[model samples]
Target: MKKKFKHIKESQLTITELMLPSHSNFSGKIHGGHILNLMDQIAFACASKHSENYCVTASVNKVDFLNPIEVGELVTLKASINYTGRTSMVVGLRVESENIRTGEKKHCNSSYFTMVAKDEAGKSAPIPGIILTTKDEIRRFARSITRQNEGRHRTSRFSSKIFKTDAYIHLLEESNSKIELK
Candidate 1:
């Protein structure tokens, strides 16, 4: 049986929460960990909504914090499926912060989470394909494919057996790290 295809809008989700003092770090800004937790939640929600099955975070690809979120601001997170595999989907997440009084908005972070759909037996399950309707949707899907390929290449190249430490020793010398090879 073939799985039904779903559209991006079908599983898109947005969450807005007021940043509290409790969610702040020592510097009095919203904690990055807290934002990551929220990102995971939204990714899971979006993936499950699209797959109609339990989903777990397989990997978090990229999490770049562009701005610091203030405790008094309103933080919003948007999530949607960028690409789908046999049992996995890449959930693209964007986090933004808005100052309540000034109405100023800042892009706080952007992340990509790979989620795998699970069956009742906790095994990998088949997931629906994405229906790309617009140019932006097509571009996102294409970018996901590129990211996946690059990840695979990196894993293979850096695998224990394949990696040659001596070949890249000079690269490390350029950094602050000291090679205390025993």
Candidate 2:
């Protein structure tokens, strides 16, 4: 059977939740872990929507927290399929927080999650190709390829066997970390 293609917009998802006091940390800000948990959920939803199968998180790419979310704020998470491979798709998620009283919003975080479609037998299943409808969609697809390549290069460079501790030791001299070599 020929594989079906899905548009990037078809899998887009948005979720908003009011932050509560219980969600805050000791510093009176919403805990980063809480936000991450929400992002993961949205990523799963978006990936599953596109794949039409059970999806699992293959990897979580980068997550950068920009602003702190307050207890009284409304946190919103938007997710979409950025890129699709044979069986994996990168789910891009953005988190924003809104102050209900002032009606102001701030970007809280942005992250990318790699999700793999799964079949009933718990094997990886092929995912549909993404239909890029906008310039941003094209840019995202290209960026995803670059990001994946960079990650692979970094991993290969730092692998246990290939890594050169001696070459990097000198570069760490200016840092605060104290390294004791045996």
TM-score leader: 2
Q: Tell me the whole-model lDDT of each prediction, alpha carbons only.
A: 0.94, 0.94
Per-residue lDDT over 36-150 for candidate 2, one digit per residue giving the tens place of the 0 to 100 score? 8999899999999999999999899878889989999999999999999999999999999999999999998888999999999999999899999899999999999999999
Clashing pairs in 2: none
- Could you give candidate 1's per-residue lDDT for residues 81-120 as a string of tens digits? 9999899999999999999999999999998999999999
Off by over 4 Å in 1: none
TM-score (C-alpha) between model 2 and the true structure: 0.97
Please give the distance, in angstroms, between residue 48's alpha carbon in candidate 1 and its true position after superposition.
0.5
Among all windows of 10 consecutive residues in model 1, the one with the lowest summed lDDT is 173-182
